[model samples]
Target: MPHIKVVGLGGSLKPGSASVLALKEALRGAEEAGAHIELFELHALDLPMFVPDRAPPESVQRFVDSVSTAAAMIWSSPVYHGSMSGAFKNALDWLELLSKHSPPYLTDKVIGLIATAGGVQGLQAINAMEFAVRSLRGYTHPLTAPLDRAWQLFDQSGQFSDEATLVRLRTLGKGVAEAAKKMAVLG
Candidate 1:
């Protein structure tokens, strides 16, 4: 089988945030599943707000290109006010550039959704992302990781302290890569 690429996008502006750490762990699972992985931390990307009529910036172009070429993706976001962070949403907005691609926005791509929250609203963010994935014409893995009380899951060093949750996140990643491979063969 040919190698597949999995792109990971999301994370809060705070460095080493729980959401980012979770994303890394999930990407590790994808790598173990024989897929190449690329991560786009929102803080590093510093993407500007989407302007419908304006040309995309270099960072936006790079992000869109990566998403366009990837066979699968893992999105991890921190829930803010019962939804995904604004920066994460803005990054998704940049995917509008992919509308001109031959297959268009996320077509044929499989996505895994993960959301971390201080309270119990992580699932809300995941639900919100599901709508976006559908709008982009992508398939989402049935296994999703909605990490509630994210602050307690990580240690002082930002590593996941809960083994079960960690395993769930990794399973989500592996599921996405495996699904993407099946889709590739079918398509």
Candidate 2:
């Protein structure tokens, strides 16, 4: 019985941001589902702007490496102007480097999408992420989580205050891990 690795990618630059906290909760769920986890802390990653012609920086290379090994992924983003944050999008852009791999970018990997927004616009971010994941050849989980009024959902310590939201986030994580495990076993 090998361990399945589920990587989390996305989060805001602000410390204890709602988006980050949501991502943490989702990862915790993945852990509960008997999988190992790796989180790409977006705020801590000093990634340069993505330029198609330029060489990838060390951080970008490391991100690509981490993603390449994952059996499943959880992407949590903050919605901005009806879309995902540029930082999260840029990180996904870096997955282009994975084209050289045997399976190519995100190919056949299970990805769970989550988004947080101040209002009820989180779905826009999740939709954008789904498009990106599909373009990368990853399978997006049918069960996605969107946290609206994100500011009210998490406390100052970054913990979710609502039990229902917590359950949803955890369910998304567990779903991704379970799907990934099945994929790993079948392949």
CA lDDT, every prediction? 0.92, 0.90
Across 15-92, the per-residue lDDT of candidate 1 in tens digits comes to 788899999999999998989999999999999999997988898888888888899999999999999999899999
Put down candidate 2 lDDT per residue, 1-187, tens digits, no spaces. 4589999988988777678788888999999999999998899986888888689888888888989999999999999899999988888888888887999999989999999999999898999999999899999999999888988876667678889999999999999999999898888
Instruction: Quote each prediction's TM-score.
Output: 0.98, 0.96
Among all candidates shown, the one with the greatest TM-score: 1
Error of 2 at 171 (Å): 1.1
